[model samples]
Target chain A: MKLSRAVVIVSTCCLLAAAARADEAPLEGQVLVLSAASTTDAVDALRAAFVKTHPQVTVDAGFAASSALAQQIAAGAPADVYLSANERWADFLDEKGLVARRRDLLSNRLVVVVADDSKLEVKRPADLEQQGIDHVALADPTSVPAGIYARQALAELGLWQDLEAKVVSAADVRQAMQLVVSGAAEAAIVYASDAATSDRVRVAVELDESLSEPIRYPVVLLNRGAERPAAVAFYDYLLSAEAADVFRRYGFLVMADDHPAADAVPVAAAQRWWGLSRDEWLALRLSFQVGLCAVVASLPVAIAAGYVLARWQSRAKWVLELVVNLPLVLPPVVTGLLLLFVFSPKGPIGGALAGTLGIEIVFTWLGAAIASAVVSFPLMVRAIRLAFQAVDPRLEMVARSLGAGRADAFFSVTLPLARSGVLAGCVLAFARSLGEFGATIMVAGNIVGETQTIPLAIFSAGNRPGFEAEVWRLASISIVLAALALVASEWLERRHATREST
Target chain B: MNRLSFRCAHRFAGGFALDAAFETDAQVTALFGPSGSGKTSILYMIAGLLRPREGAIALGKQIWLDTRRGIDTRPERRRVGFVLQDHLLFPHLSVERNLTYGLRRRRGENSAIEASRVIEVLELGDLLARYPRNLSGGEKQRVALGRSLLSGPQLLLMDEPLAALDAPLKDRVLSYLERVVEEWHVPTIYVSHNASEVRRLAERVIMLERGRVVHSGSADELLLEGYSPSGDWEA
Candidate 1:
């Protein structure tokens, strides 16, 4: 008996010693872990714990919408492990035979959120239909996972019908949260994680779990990932009790092993606002503002240059024309890089502006305006120059003969005659400004609200996406806006011509 | 003493050189020439539209152009109204606006010539609201003469203002032009190849051929002398 007892103590001590050693030794090699954006905080905590036990291992965690990660993996992205926010996306990968192994990881709650100072009150899903709430922002239910959950919840609660008119959609849960922060809407429905991240909004209502679709995230291992020992180790570590605690700590309602077996619907949800998003709306507004300001800012200079090119007799006139047209000829990226070099903080002009004038253009809306103005300046000058050329010089001479000075002749006679061309020029410049991207991104730095015009916003939003539809929507809106401007100017030109003809 | 004295020498790109000098205080002096003569060049120089290679010009001692002394005034400030062969009414402006333009720039002096009187004399009363492009050639010429008259200019320069008109229209516009200068008492330099026009419009005449003044005398004497198309005479 004494000998058996001693043997048990030695084996137990050996097991304890082995566990201690594993805690001290860092894991070896690298692992590329992809996680749903909703669980980014939880995944980061999981990575921290994994690296602590296996200090030699480096985990690179890329967080995006779960559906996006699945699509990326299907498109041959080498993801080791995917912690998705929904079973549908994981099932999508599994159907492609890209998933080597998978299990349900975590679940999340859908909550309606409102600004802290909002006078609007809502305690239940039906409360969303209350009189005080005219606009309710949510993730695009057609594609975004949170939006799908919100839609399911609203449908089950029988409030979808009444709230349809009041609903405004966003690109994702985070953007839905932004609607409340921006005060563009009275309330929003987003994932609890997104609400937890923002301090400006508070949860107005917690959706009933039974009414919504089961919000379970399934973690999957891509086929390639299963072969990597470190990837498999990281995958195992995520499923451990330690990761569960992290998920729980961050407001994820952790669930058991099974998820819904319902086939993933690849079909996007029914159209809302013809598939417009808050990001797209903001982008449109920002684009027009930038284009208009750019045109207004550069018009005087463009007019002067155009007048000289049209009327002056100089050998260097062609050279001036060529110089003005250079931006149109050069690649936009080259223009962007050159502007970046000149306007960056360490650069000469940027430094002077910051130090002396307390003015900052780099990474600001003004910088975006400057970038677009430079890009579109040639178009404006060219149009106005052609207009000026078409004017009979005799008309100006007559004005001068009538005691009108140079400035007076231009303002009174020449400019009025060139009205259609001037308007056409402004439209062209404005359209160009709307599409300006490369230079604006370099100079304005694509800050979400301030410097992000439509193009830059499209790029930034496109970066964190399964948002192909959203991006295309934005692109089409911009095209429509530009087309409307063109049509309006053309109509005005025709009207002026008809009036002249009579 | 002559109220306007101008001396200018200019060379054309086609190698035609205009070396001319003349003085006139007549209420209307016509510069008579054939199509290629330098009548227009002389008028252009006095109006400061053309820079003479070397010259001096004065209107009642105002010293309009004295290149040697670097004293050249801009055309608008010179108070000289110029009417071109094309009438040169601003196509964008109505006849009324065209007339008001120079009147507006009277610069500290209220217009001495009334707009209504000038309009009526030129028969532009019917066309006041019409754009220059909308006016007939004769109507345009009427508006042009009226516009110049309203400016209250010290001198009026007309370069074939009746050249584009038919015989009857020319006679009508010529009558208006005559009345404007007589009424305003403005020193006028009228350019034309038509000897009859010179005789009817001018108190004195200077005939030019091949960029040189071939004759100058009273309108009847110059017309009687005739513009020698072959440049046979000297000033």
Candidate 2:
């Protein structure tokens, strides 16, 4: 009977050990985390820390304005976890039945900031009303959560009515802080964390928490991520003691009751192809694809415009010239915004196109291509026009007299002669498209793989504190691409010159 | 034989004016004039390259242009071959491609002026693979003439075709022109400021002076009135 009891105890011990083994199975698969722009540094640090312990898991992150991230999630972006700077967007997702679980993750304080060398002293919200503070920058008060908090603080202090006239609205908190850093604004109202990012700007006043609603960041795991074990592990790790410490270091007030921190393990440097990570390679490849599509799509229209501008003699020619060249001189962002208006779902052309053909352009690669095409059009046309202008008009006339139609003459005679210029223009346009950022971000929304090009990737990398290496890498790639394009065009022009002089 | 009639009045932006009129059924008619006398302008209007402010141009029963009637046939539909003063050979095309360009565009089944025949008559066989940029001035003019001939035009307009060549090259190209005209008796209007070029090429001559038709007669009668071998008319 003692032997029987011993066997039974052994079986029990074996069962317990098997269960423990099952619990310790390594988490694998990818976790996509979409976070607020203000949380970029904290999130990057947390991701680095998390990946160290869960070495088999990959955590891909995207950071933008919370509203944009929420919209992306609503539009069916494959985001596993979303960390918004405010509860409103999280609640919006919950109402849409998109959120499976959520909790308040962190909080922040709003502050007034001024340039490091500024003579104006802004100790209180009322100080912003001084004549010395001619301009004050803030994130868009109507939409961005940081700006809304700043607006509430100003209203609570009874300074909103007087200081509203001097306010310059920026797209995001970092941009608002950048204005003060650049001395473009006498002061700016931004998050304390963002203000801490730049040594060029100094925090003048931290608005009392009582002045505005408590600024809470809510983290949510979407329904799409509920079944993914790696996503759940990453989401749970975000609330652990290690992540809380990261948040605290980045000036955020950690609100989660953190669990025990994971073991600190060193992560191996990710494998690189030609000194670029997988994501950076994806961005580089997308840039070339988009640049090529832009050039190919715009070539026929550009050629026609160039031909008309070169040969047509009319009093109204200047009008056509101005319209063709407007994009070259306009702020690329303004050009992007204009394209957004015409290509948005509610727009006339966009609505009709979607209704009839089911073609959605906004936030897609095609939208990116269109933006690049528009931004690079003037350069293409100018080069092509110069090329066409250099061709003798008599050759076309001779073709015409030889029973060739206008189009036939152009294709056979004029276009062939201007081929080098057209090639140069194409290269120039492609290079310009590769560097197109302002319009691409506005229209394409910086979605990874779908629209994030090299320039956009660089912009994102530049915003995050720990990604300086990534920023330099992407910037160097851009320079290399542009240099190669310039070399190709120079070679073409030289060949054309030699052919002509021969 | 089809009769060709032309009348036009045009004013240049620089205030120069052209008012000329003539009708001919000859195989070769020359618009003889000095520089700025609007010889090339008349050829351009006839070929539909330029529109006169007031004009009517016709070849036999075909009304190519009548401004008052609001009818102006496009240059391609007019079926008139034009060889410019610069021998405007398509610089990007080889000699063979240039010669066949117009031949390929001919809408009619009129294969009377075959590409091989034109190539042989113009002696363009050796230069077929060479681009216009690689050809000499005289070679370019011959290729231009061959290209125009292969189009099977109802009429050919020669705008001082040898004007760009030096004297020796001009004589060689003029000989090629005579061979082309002899092989295919296409009705032609040749424009030249040089009296000798006109005398060599024209059966009938229409003299232009200060934008008006000063005289119209046989080439011998008009050119011999006051012409010199140096191509100047005695003032």
Candidate 3:
């Protein structure tokens, strides 16, 4: 049933492929080409070619894991085309009748890769089951297209059962390959196209064609393209012989030169504040979760630090201050790198946690929250310390004279006096945590549903070839949330100021 | 006789040395001294809020401090109530809560002062809900006195508690203080530099100069104009 659809799409593309450049003047506006992650280089190459003939047209290409790209299209993200790595995701949008045009453009081969220094030998699919072979990283098979294809290939070879226990599922094909690079997994099975991009690993074995399912890249023009003529011209250009040659240069087999929303979404977009794609909504929701967890987790420690800094009289007080403020002064990326070293599987802290406690932090939502808490902790401590300082020590002395214990005096009198400042500190910390990116990415890898916070989503969406629209959507959500938190913090501080006068 | 006996050598920083030794059993013994003459310092030491370098302070049956024995009791456990010049009423609490704060502490432990009795004595029924921030200087001092008295302390130290009030307010609060002493019969050490205050309040006065007690006499004799700084009494 899918074979018929590809054939019809090719014949349709061939008819307009030549005529697409006949009048280049009409292709002056932007043409968005949305594709899977593996096709970034190839898509760039095609855009370069198309620009030589139609220099007036701008082709914005975005790339991501196929399923994520498909969900974006289904959520009515404004884009001109969809160039996907597998048939299922395209079929997903097709079922929703989102496809205005569809075609098969390319095919890819799968290979098993191992680190360059490893002694482990996997000459065939069956060789992956050796005794020393620990984890085999693969993109999540239940959902990710690459994992789905890898599963088919392994099941055909009868190798899936033996390796199932050793599988450490990655979020995407690139991440699967990265697992081997970091020595977290002994081997990873990824597309030959992705394998060519990295030099740290060698393709130990390429699975035979008969054992693997036929890998196909499909391209679709969504209903949003009807608004832009340049988008349709670019869609036709993708199926041209010129685009096929560029695909081959990127190590993708040139089958058809295989490759791999806007108007309908305007009503939802009109809502402005409430309008959000599912992924954007999730990003907002996850940001709040991470922010709240981060603040809640660090509050006790922050309060203790605040009290000590405010009241403790010791020579080492300056040292404590410096240590609390260290994260604020250090570059966030440096902080992330330091966290990665401690939390990575081979690193001291992460190794013990994973082995002894069965707690996994790397590439998980918990790790993201911890990273956020660390960065926002200093601000909380500083504000709380100021609040503590504002309270008169004599009040506590009077409380003590009234037969109140130190702890009782603190809770009843001191803490209540400083409540406004402490509340303002919490709001500021939450807002800062929501925007945290560098430290978060260092400790928690960007896994869309699990660890990808608002900043992470904005970063990846902006970098993706055609997902610029998604970037704006995520960015706007971040801005709105942060602004609200600031307003709340400001209101609390004003209350504190007014309290001081009375 | 009921008494407070204490001896402290206040060789504090900045070369300020106080060699003080006193034993008083009078109904009211005023710590009469100018500023920086260690009057409030003695009151704080008795209250257990401040520690002296070397001292043994015992109020009748209880030993409040014995630095030689390493028995410096915590202020909260010492059963000593202090009302400083500023009143020092907890600004965050209402008059009722402040009054009951110490009363709550002594609960179920054979407490002497009752919260309702304190409320009636201080006339704080209308001011129960009002915070210290909203109270006048005299009202605050009354509340502070009420709070301390309600704690059922063995020793009550007033370090010029009415000094911040105006003339009329000071007289009014002073009468209340006199009534408290007459009614509760708590051992009171009222610190005052004013001659009129010493005459009006203290039955006995101990004059202090340069951290030394120079005179021990009735308030009337101490207030005589011919009372000299060159002491006739040994300090």
Candidate 4:
């Protein structure tokens, strides 16, 4: 079905090009091509080579996550061409007639990767089924193309049904690789291109190419009526022997050059908030709940740590502060692994709770919240610490003089004075939780509508060929959410300030 | 009648020591001294806010502090009122709330001063609902006085209470103090550098210099005519 769609797309692109060439000659002028950061290296090399050969035209390239780039395009941003990591996005533009023509540039393979120095042996793809080796990282299959391929591969192997309890879905293929490379997970199924970017990890088993749809990278010229000659030229240059060699070096499988279909999305597709499907939205809602829970749960601890670090006269205060902020410095995957090591069923806390209290955290939403909280905890403490420090000690002293005891003084004076900082910390925690990827994936095992957040949704969306639009949609929503959170924090801080003064 | 007596010895580093011993049966006894003369320190020790190395403080038949037995009490349990040099009024609470705090904490006590009587005694009726930020220095000090009185303390310790106010404002508060001491007859140890206050308010004067008591006598005798450097009773 996908092959037939590609054929139709290629024929449509060819027809469009022929008609354009007959009417207005070949496109000409300076070109701007925006692409996903994953393709940054490939696109950069291609741009340099293209610009060197054609001195009259210059190619200005912009790189971001595919969803971000696609949103910029849909917003009618000044971009001549957009080359995405998957065909779904290009197909979206084609359906909207936003693209003059779409073309399949390259193909990618999905494979299971592990840390090069990993102790667990995975001689066969089915070895991922081992029970003790619980953590299996993958991109969210709904939104990210890599995640889709990984899920498809899992389903094909009949592993998806049994592996549901073990699967940890990262926000993106990069994060999935991080999970395995950091020893947080036993294995991660990612694109070969992604695995090539890291030295710490190596591909363990190549996913059966026939099991899942081919990972096709498609390029679309977005300026249809006012065709960007430079953009079209850059697109053509991608098909040249030189650019193809660079793409090949990046582990992309070169496909026969072909035009793209005019109508890319079939009927009966679910509408999304950016790239997230209904299930992914449920994941997002769950992510929000988890993030909020993490922040709220950690708030008292953060505030206490902030107070002690800010005001306590103990000799060990500095050491405590450093310990509190350690999560900020360590990589998130490391934090996740640390959490897993301590919270897994056999881990101390895990064993104690499960054995004594029967409260299991492994592969649970609560576990995911804990992972996100650990990573985001430092942010809350830092923010709250600053807030606590800014409080005038005189206020507490005055409360004491007015017959209030220490705790009463704190509640009456110190807490109110630091309200803005607390609010700012909570906002930061919320935003960080919404976007949390690595730690959450490791602890929660991306069960759809269970632990996945907006970032995970976008990451999963990026894996499918035709899900680029969905990824872009999710990306747009995430950006909006993050922006809204920041603005709200600033507003809250100002409001608190005014109230305190009044 | 409440009578407070302190025979206290406190040591500072490098051999400096504050050796003070005095007894006050009067309604107001002034500890007159310049800054760093251990006047505030004595008040703090008397209020049980500070622990002196060697001291004995007795209020009437009650032995509040005794170095020999090591029976010191925490500030909250001590029945003493302390007004600091600056009015340390609770900024968040209204004047009435601040005045009522200690009273409420000592809940179910029959001897506790009624909140209404405190408001009337300190002339804090109009300022009751107002927050500390809205109150002037004189007003705050009066409220502080009211709050202290409401706690039903045996003795009141005023540590340079008018130091932060200007002369005119100080006079206004000092006049109010005279009225309160005369009408309520609250036993008091008032610390101040102004000699005239010693003459007008305190019948007995405890003079301190460099953390040591130099003299103790009637206020009139210390500020005696021809005894001053100018040999004149200016006031």
Candidate 5:
């Protein structure tokens, strides 16, 4: 009896042990790292090293301008780490108590880069004053750290006053580099780290460090709940000797100190009165007005086409489907170019419109919205078609059987069931319209308030000098809006699905 | 004088097809068949919901569909009604709105049917304001029927209207259908498979097997011969 009791006690002990093991299973920690758009390489290099040391942890990294990253972190992203290109963001995080430790772990140098085979003669800072230079790319001095440094260098060289008119603000330093590489701009100011990552652009000159404020990157450990240990581990690993080598290899100078100054600028909260400048607000409101117009404008055509696709069973369906999906498949820039080629003042459609109707689409907000709508129209049709498909054809048939004509049956039955899908499609189209950048920028030049939407504002702000805080503010607002939109769509879809099943 | 009579043929992609030529002087004539034998297509052809490759359909004095003369009437102007296999009631609109849609379509139509008479005939007096979502399967079909009838159509095309209901519900709805046919006296093309239902509801039967009409005879004659169109019939 004692032996049997001992055996039972042992079994119970094993069960308890197994339960304890389950309870003590290794914790899951996700570490988010936000890096400036141009510093993607540096951030990636640092993350790779840190992750090597902590293989159990998952890292979520986003690359945007330092200003945009700061804005996103400020807007309550569950980030565990923020690595900004300059001290401004670290200081902002320090003020909010979001940063575990404000440390200036790295320094970056600013340089002007040009495409390798460019004809533009840009040898020195003063050479930028030369005539015939149509476009010069830079991060907006207001928000991006690299752009701020570039502006300081230009100011020190007395080039800022002369270069203002020729400048085109990009959303981030990386995009600025792209402008130079794509031959869209004559030259762009980017980080030495950024220049090292691309082979298409050649460094024109490294500006004297003394001409600008010292480029310091502050590394902060975010206080994300339930992930504190992993966050701190990743943070500690960043300051380790091995990670410092990676930073140095990537053309960044590791700073001895990592502390945010008490007098650093406030991490600006998202500005909500549509959270845009007068020009940006106008663009946003116009985007809405135009998006609604575009959707309404395309409604008849889309409805007719959608019906043909869904119900007609015509032999020409394949051709129509291809046309409908063409805008989606083509690159935005290509779509913009196609529009430009057709709508340029001298182009065929443009010539007709301008010559006959006294209307033009060149560099116009209407044009931008049209381009946006055309590119996004497929999404609307697809959503609407799905809604129509969900509706039972029998309903219409029943109406006909009751002495209702075909038109009567359609009005009574098929349209109602497709309501939810149509609404969803409209929302999707509207969002796509608001966020459209490339096609809008190409088709409608970044004319402030006239064509500059929030995305364009954020881009230009990132490129503009002394507009960093504003860029952060706008980015934060956009992120919040986008998140809200996603949540709403998800909730709406779930409710509809539940109703359909029940 | 006969108010509604028609003959039509329908062709689809591939060779799978249906051809029918019939005339009905009575209130109801059923085109009975198994599933997917082109019964619905025939109803669609009659209501002008579908166009035929080569056929003629005339309702009273109106030439609805004639391929040779290139005279095809739109479904909205055909003035013929239809009821489908499943009750296709609008979930968004109330029963009253569903009934009024047809009235709105016929705004200039002088002989438009009365809404009150339809409500009374279909026994939907209490359910006029409710939505299709708030209705039973049988109730929805009744509203669908009332809405169609209120459009002032010359004829009705019903494609297995009670196929979705339970046996008890079908019986209850069938009796209401009988009242509609008798009181309205509108010519109807009723499609069904239930032999008993066809016998009770229709005066004549045009039986289709595969895609061709196998028999066209009085309901009693077809029942006695077991609906075989094999002897001395021209190919």
Candidate 6:
């Protein structure tokens, strides 16, 4: 009996030791995770729980629009795991052999949201087209996963064609929600999780699953991190019950082992115009309008500033020059944000204008023009200043001796001599404006047929799956336009030189 | 003819002080001095292009500048024609457009020198359609001279007008200058360091040395007494 008891104790002790070993396997080093912006809060909670059990493991997380993160991964960003808002980006990485393993981690439902104070009755998908719904915001349907899903659901319900005009695209789902909250948009179609985060918006309707492809968040282990034990541990921890509980708390649908199959929804065919789809053409047209308007509106001010910078001799001249060139040296996004502060409805300039003229600028084409103008102003002023400086000051003095007044001499002699530089400045500003995205997106809010310029269109296209052709087309057009502007500017400069030399 | 009386005291940043006074009613009065002797500054002051610290300048009855009275007419209203050393014609305008530039400012007043007469005397008919960038040095100077004449100024100021030209070109341009003085007979202040050019052009000479007037007399007396036989005066 003693031997039998000893044998039992030994076997039980061995089993208990093995169990302890399995639970305490130390995970060391760093695991970098790139996640969708919508899943940031949930991922943070999951990371906290994961580090508690594996104290040696450090979790570093980055969150942005899923499509942008996927692009970054494809460009060889040092990311071990990617949690995409939809399966498309994961599939994109998988097709490129960048994803080592992937699984559907969570599901989310689409909801149409309106301001909490809104009295409009929106019962179904068709209700989006009802009267008083002037503008509907969505994630960029061409590129962003949320917007693609929203576009699919709208197309499935046959309301896309009619409601397309009122749809304004945001860079991401969070931005779409913010659009509704800020009252820049009357309505927004966003993930249920995103809607829950905002108190200003009320969910009007939850879209049925049958209306579009199943909205699934897929967690992926990238090939770069497949060999790292810390990354593998973090990847497994993301799929554990603790992580699922956190996701569920954040209004995400925790996927079961047996989830619904993903159906391949047919993409709607786009109508073509001049070898480009209607939306692409609209973006191109809007880019031209914004570019021309920006150059025309800012030219007089730029010329005057250029003249002062070139000719004025004073201690305060450096300060004027610094102010004029500030936008050039600053990051485009920062410039955009500064412009937003000055041009928002509640902003000083915007408030006075709106109060007196009843004219709003935010989310409008004029806002896009203003953003482009501000960003391109430095380039214009620099070129024009150099041009004016190149003209002989004695020419003006001689004109004065010929009985011409100060203003007369400038108009007749100085302006004619500096015409080439002025023209070159215009072309440069136009090109700069055409490629303006960061600031324009910030102030203008990417409204289709209104503020969606070529760069913005390319950004939207770049974020969508299976829109590679459209992206290439828009990108090529931009390249061609920039090349032509540069060539024309060079030709003008050369002509000016040859004329002076002769 | 209106007599021009000018007296000025000015100090340049380089410590060059100019204190001189003269009066002339001659058709061509020469400001004879070497370069950097404040000759250009005096001519500029007379044209209202430069301001003196204290000065009184009168062309006949009109006061172009008087520091005591605070009467400083603008350069354009002073109607003093200036022929720059470089003949600074508008590079963008055609030769004809450059000649006609000052005509636009002479509205309501009848111009004594007609465009046709100036063009005929300067022989600029062949260069009318050409731009200044295409013109030779002598041609540019002729255009500059004709441009000034057409403005019908009360006085003309020429600052080393032949300084940029070669010796051969200078002789040809000098003949053109002689014709302008003999034909239009405008009261003129001509600046030059070349004594021979002054002898050929000026009735009276104000000799300057280190920014001060050392002598003032007929061109023959000043050039003979102060200048070397080589017709060049050294500062």
Q: Which of the numbered candidates is closest to the native, going by highest TM-score?
A: 2
**TM-score for each predicted model, relative to the true structure:** 0.63, 0.78, 0.64, 0.60, 0.61, 0.66
Model 1: per-residue Cα lDDT at residue A8: 57
Clashing pairs in 2: none
Ranked by DockQ from best down, the candidates are 2, 6, 3, 1, 5, 4
**Model 3 per-residue lDDT tens digits across residues A228-284:** 788888998888887776676666776742244001110111124446766566677
Top candidate by DockQ: 2
Q: Which is the better candidate, 1 or 3, if ranked by DockQ?
A: 3
lDDT of 3 by residue, B1-235 (tens): 4798988876776888887888888878888877888988888787677789998988787888899999888888877788999888876677888888888887355656677777777788889899888988888898899999888887788888877888889889888888877777777788977767777788888888999998788877777756443332222
TM-score of chain B of each: 0.92, 0.96, 0.91, 0.89, 0.89, 0.97
Write candidate 2's Cα lDDT for B63-112 as tens digits: 99999999999999988889888888887778888898999999884758
Superposed by TM-score, candidate 3 places the C-alpha of residue B2 at a distance from the truth, in angstroms, of: 4.0
Angstrom error of the Cα, residue A32, model 1: value is 27
User: Model 1 over residues A315-387: C-alpha lDDT tens digits?
Assistant: 8889998889999989887887787677655678777876887665765566788899999999899888888
Report the poorest 10 consecutive residues by lDDT, candidate 1 chain A: A261-270
Report lDDT (CA) for all predictions: 0.75, 0.83, 0.78, 0.72, 0.70, 0.83
What clash pairs does model 1 have? A26-A54, A26-A55, A27-A54, A27-A55
- Give the poorly placed runs of model 5, Cα more than 4 Å off: A1-293, A393-413, A464-467, A490-502, B1-6, B107-113, B226-235
Please give the TM-score that candidate 6 achieves against the real structure.
0.66
Interface Cα RMSD per model, in Å? 2.5, 1.5, 1.9, 3.7, 4.1, 1.4
List DockQ, one per candidate, in order: 0.33, 0.52, 0.41, 0.11, 0.19, 0.49
CA-RMSD of model 1: 21.7
Task: Report the C-alpha lDDT of model 5 over B119-201, residue by residue, as the tens digit.
Answer: 88788999988877788889988987887787777777888988888889988889988998877777888998777677778
Error of 6 at A344 (Å): 1.8
Across residues A1-502, which tens digit of lDDT does each residue of candidate 5 receive?
3323533554465456435433643434556666666656556557666667667765546566777666645644345677888887788877877766757787777888888787777778888777757778888777878778888899999989889888898878878887886678888888776677666678888888898999887777776622568778777877887777666666666677353212212112234544455545665565665565566556556656666677867688899999998988888888877786777766788779878986657555567767777887887788777767776676665455444566656655666556556656666766667777777766665544345677877876554323556777777767876676566656655555666431
Q: Which regions of candidate 6 are displaced past 4 Å?
A: A1-274
The model with the greater TM-score, 3 or 4, is 3
